[model samples]
Target: MNENPHPTRQLEEAPVHDQFDVTLEDADLLGEVELTTNLIIAASESDEHLEAEEIDRILGVVPSPREDG
Candidate 1:
């Protein structure tokens, strides 16, 4: 018993992007932030060793807090 009567309806139309406006650069930045956050969380939870490049990438995405303000 399928709850959605038109299961394939979503596939027939184009994707709707009315929720928010995000440029390509913004989208890429968001993706990097998301990946870095996930990696940081995973590293904190497990004892796995992160490669030098991975560590650099994660550090690059995280913003440093202001000291003066």
Candidate 2:
């Protein structure tokens, strides 16, 4: 029960830019999902809730806090 009239139709006539645009969009979405999943795992394994400073450290945005700071 496919809704699209051209469900099996080929994209042979489609423009190259259109084809590659979709590919790039898909890759970007996949990367975003992967990063989010990894962050969630890191947070869950951490002893305490992830703070802004800790998150920055994980992302290498800032240096790790000093023990005496």
Candidate 3:
């Protein structure tokens, strides 16, 4: 009389963590992740691959080996 075909199968709740173990040092990494995600989204909107200027602009915003010098 069960509506579900797989009535024997039971679903379990996923584990939840109220707190994260992030540190101040992780802020820079998180920022980079945000930037990269935005770049990916913007690139997906365009039909063609990233242009030289666009690549340069991204590189300019992000830290690179050249910046270390």
Candidate 4:
């Protein structure tokens, strides 16, 4: 004698770990990821193309020597 067409299912709660370790390298990588994501967003919004120097600056990359002179 069930009137409801669907029945609710119960979900088990997952245990939470209060203690977590963060390394300096992990933080640096996270910062780099954030910066890259922001750059991608800005690039997608802009109509103009990004210059090589600008790209290098945003990625913190050193510009290599161009042989095509």
Better of 3 and 4 by TM-score: 3
Q: On residues 1-69, what C-alpha lDDT tens digit does candidate 1 reach at each position?
A: 559765764457768887567555687788877877888786897677887666766666554678996
Candidate 4, 2-42: lDDT as tens digits: 67777787889898765665444687789988888978986
Between which residue pairs do clashes occur in model 1?
A: none
Tens digits of per-residue lDDT for model 2 on 1-69? Answer: 659875786657755465545444587788777677778889989998899877766655767678985
Off by over 4 Å in 2: 1-25, 59-69
Question: Candidate 4 — what's its lDDT?
Answer: 0.80
Best by lDDT: 4
Question: lDDT of each prediction vs. the true structure?
Answer: 0.72, 0.74, 0.75, 0.80
Q: lDDT (0-100) at residue 35 of candidate 2?
A: 70
Candidate 3 lDDT over 1-69, as tens digits, reads 549776686789998865785554687888888778878887988899988678668656554556545
Model 1 lDDT at residue 53 = 66
Record all residue pairs in model 4 with backbone atoms less than 3 Å apart, i.e. clashing.
Answer: none
Q: How far is candidate 3 from the true structure (C-alpha RMSD, Å)?
A: 10.9
Off by over 4 Å in 4: 1-25, 62-69
Residue 34, model 4: lDDT of 81
Q: List the RMSD of every prediction in angstroms.
A: 13.1, 12.0, 10.9, 10.0
Query: Rank order by lDDT, top first?
Result: 4, 3, 2, 1
RMSD of 4: 10.0
